[model samples]
Target: MDITQDQTLDITSFFCPMTFVHTRLALDRMTSGEKLVLILNDGDARRNVAASAQALGHVIEADESLPGNRARLVIRK
Candidate 1:
């Protein structure tokens, strides 16, 4: 299914737990099946965020790395 994102969040400046914390909060604020696009920096933010989201059973639609060691992550809540 093609899911259109209902919101976008930038957790690039956030670190570790806060990265996934903010992302999780955003997803919680959204309704079911709604898509959320997140902007996250590479390294721990990237690895932890994906792991955190997946652990919560949120469906990951896309995880594409961009320039400047950043990535665009799409999650379905």
Candidate 2:
């Protein structure tokens, strides 16, 4: 349940499809009770990432904005 201590993937520089692609792949590698943190830039990721995660049944643990137009999303698998 504590995701901050688990695996994290930073895809801030990656755009649209690649961001979702990498997120999906990372989530697949985690165990059922495990979690992953995804760092994304502002824009498409805000919409697409969460939508994709919801569709795949992954839990969106936390979503917050960081300084300078970045967002941090914690997801569970």
Candidate 3:
């Protein structure tokens, strides 16, 4: 299903824990069923953010690769 995001977070300049930290903070501010479009760098940030968000019980609607070494994670809170 296609989800329309309520917010967008660009964490391409952040690393590990901070990446997820910021994403989590953003999710926390939103209500249930709200969508978040998170743009993060590839590698650990991508992997860890997805894992952490799932661990928090949020739904990962989609994960897409960008032109550069980056990815977009679509999450539902």
Candidate 4:
């Protein structure tokens, strides 16, 4: 079953290290088992955020492409 997101973090305006920085901050604020939908720009933002979250032992529920150069990432903290 798909877990519902408890919050959203849009880091489309950020890049590289800052992308994961904000993502980690938001995850820190969430309780265990809660989910978050993170919106990011394509390419580096997409790869960086997802990889960083995974490295931290977070679960990635979904990773999909949006219209234009954006991506929708669902993470469970």
Identify the candidate with maximal TM-score. 3
lDDT of 4 by residue, 1-77 (tens): 46577998888988889999899889999999999999899898898888889999999999999998999999998
How far off is residue 36 in model 3, in Å?
A: 0.4
Candidate 2 clash figure, as a count: 0
Q: Write the per-residue lDDT of candidate 1 for residues 1-77, one digit (tens) a residue.
A: 35588999988888888898899889989998999999999888988888888899998899889899999889988
Worst 10 residues of 3 by lDDT: 1-10
- What's each prediction's TM-score? 0.92, 0.90, 0.94, 0.93
Better model by lDDT: candidate 2 vs candidate 4: 4
> Residue pairs in steric clash, candidate 2?
none
Comparison by lDDT, 2 against 3, better one: 3
lDDT, candidates in the order shown: 0.88, 0.84, 0.92, 0.90
Checking candidate 3 for backbone clashes, the offending pairs are none
Q: Which stretches of candidate 4 lie over 4 Å from their true place?
A: 1-3
Candidate 3 C-alpha lDDT tens digits along 1-77: 46687999999988888999899899999999999999999888998999999999999999989989999999999
- What lDDT, from 0 to 1, does candidate 4 have? 0.90
Q: Which portions of model 1 show Cα errors greater than 4 Å?
A: 1-3
